[model samples]
Target: MTTTPRRYHITTFGCQMNKADSERMAGILDNMGLISSDDPNEANIILYNTCTIRDNAEQKVYSYLGRQAKRKHQQPDLTLIVAGCVAQQEGEALLRRVPELDLVMGPQHANRLQDLLEQVFNGNQVVATEPIHIVEDITKPRRDSKVTAWVNIIYGCNEHCTYCVVPGVRGREQSRYPEAIRAEMEELGRQSYPEITLLGQNIDAYGRDLPGVTAEGRNKHTFTDLLYYVHDVPGVERIRFATSH
Candidate 1:
């Protein structure tokens, strides 16, 4: 008798960032041999990659968590996780409210999902929201579209726009090396993805933290410079970006 593979369902709230994060988390689950499930109730792993950008988005996360938290009382083996901006902001408080959660990890910890989940399987509850230098995202995101993809050229933000929570939840600026970004795009091109959107909380500020100097002795790795570098990625028809602030 063969046992069925565990299935995962991720309910995401807010922005392309949240969607992109969910895709990467899904990729992590897929790499672990977990299958994606359409119905939340039917899955063995249920993840809420949440957002705190709005009151409504935050409330929706709690509502979803409540349902899953209650279900976990009966299904002790259920692996429930809360991840993304809200996870970073709330941290241990989320684990208090939804004590059934197996893991609560921030946006910066997206690529560390496998190692974190290993801890969960070892009978540990994990919270990983502490600020850390953003690691280069090497995980292949389970892209939502075959034609378009989100490539995180930069992680986190340094700006403190009056109404923004990104700088707080995502930590300070950290740009991926341009060579790594190009390699990711090149792979996407080979996979036949025609459009790639480079993501950042404050895209205009990308490359400001990287170590480089212009011919005139100014910072060299501006967004325009990045565009020129990535534009020639073979098979990529269009390149785009978000949140120029």
Candidate 2:
């Protein structure tokens, strides 16, 4: 008799940032030898890369998690994970609400999915929400589109808009080095990707948190600088940006 390979499904709800996070997480799962499943129920690992931008979005995630949590009872080996904004905002409290969750991680922790899942494989429930310097994105993203791609030039938000949860969930602003961003874009260009979108919560403020200034008292590493730096990447025909506050 032969056992089937473990499969994973990710249910994502939110903006493009969340979608980008989901792709990176899926890439990590792929690297771990898990295949993608079109249906959540059929997969041995079910992950909800949740959103809390709206009250109903948060409630919807809970309802979905409830179903999977119940399913876990019948399939004891099933692994459940809640990641992205909701995971960051709720932290350990999420584990209290959904005891079936094997891993809870924030958006900033996306690159560390492999290690987090390893802990889960060891029979430990993990919650990683503490803010840290954003890690460089090295994992190959299982991108949703071959024609276009979303590149996060900066991670987290530094704004404190009273009505927004992004600042709390995504943490402080940390920009990726210009060289790193260019390398990723160039690779995408080589792969025949036509367009790339620079993503951020407060895109206009890209390099504010970084340590640099020009003689004119202006930040030397602004988004405009990034644009000029990457405009000529080999085969990339278009460049765009989103989520400016």
Q: Give the distance in Å from residue 200's predicted Cα in candidate 1 to where it truly belongs.
A: 0.5
Model 1 TM: 0.97
Off by over 4 Å in 2: 1-3
Q: Which regions of candidate 1 are displaced past 4 Å?
A: none
- Model 1, 124-175: lDDT tens per residue? 9999987787677767788879899998877778778898888999889888
lDDT of 2 at 178: 89
Predicted candidate 2 versus true structure: per-residue lDDT over 150-238, tens digit per residue: 99988778779898878898888889888999999999999999999999988988888778799999997999999999999999999
By summed lDDT, which 10 consecutive residues of candidate 2 come out lowest?
Answer: 153-162
Candidate 2 lDDT: 0.91
- In model 1, what is the error at residue 115, expressed in angstroms? 0.6
Q: Please give the lDDT score for candidate 1.
A: 0.89
lDDT of 1 at 171: 88
- Candidate 2 residue-wise lDDT at 207: 84
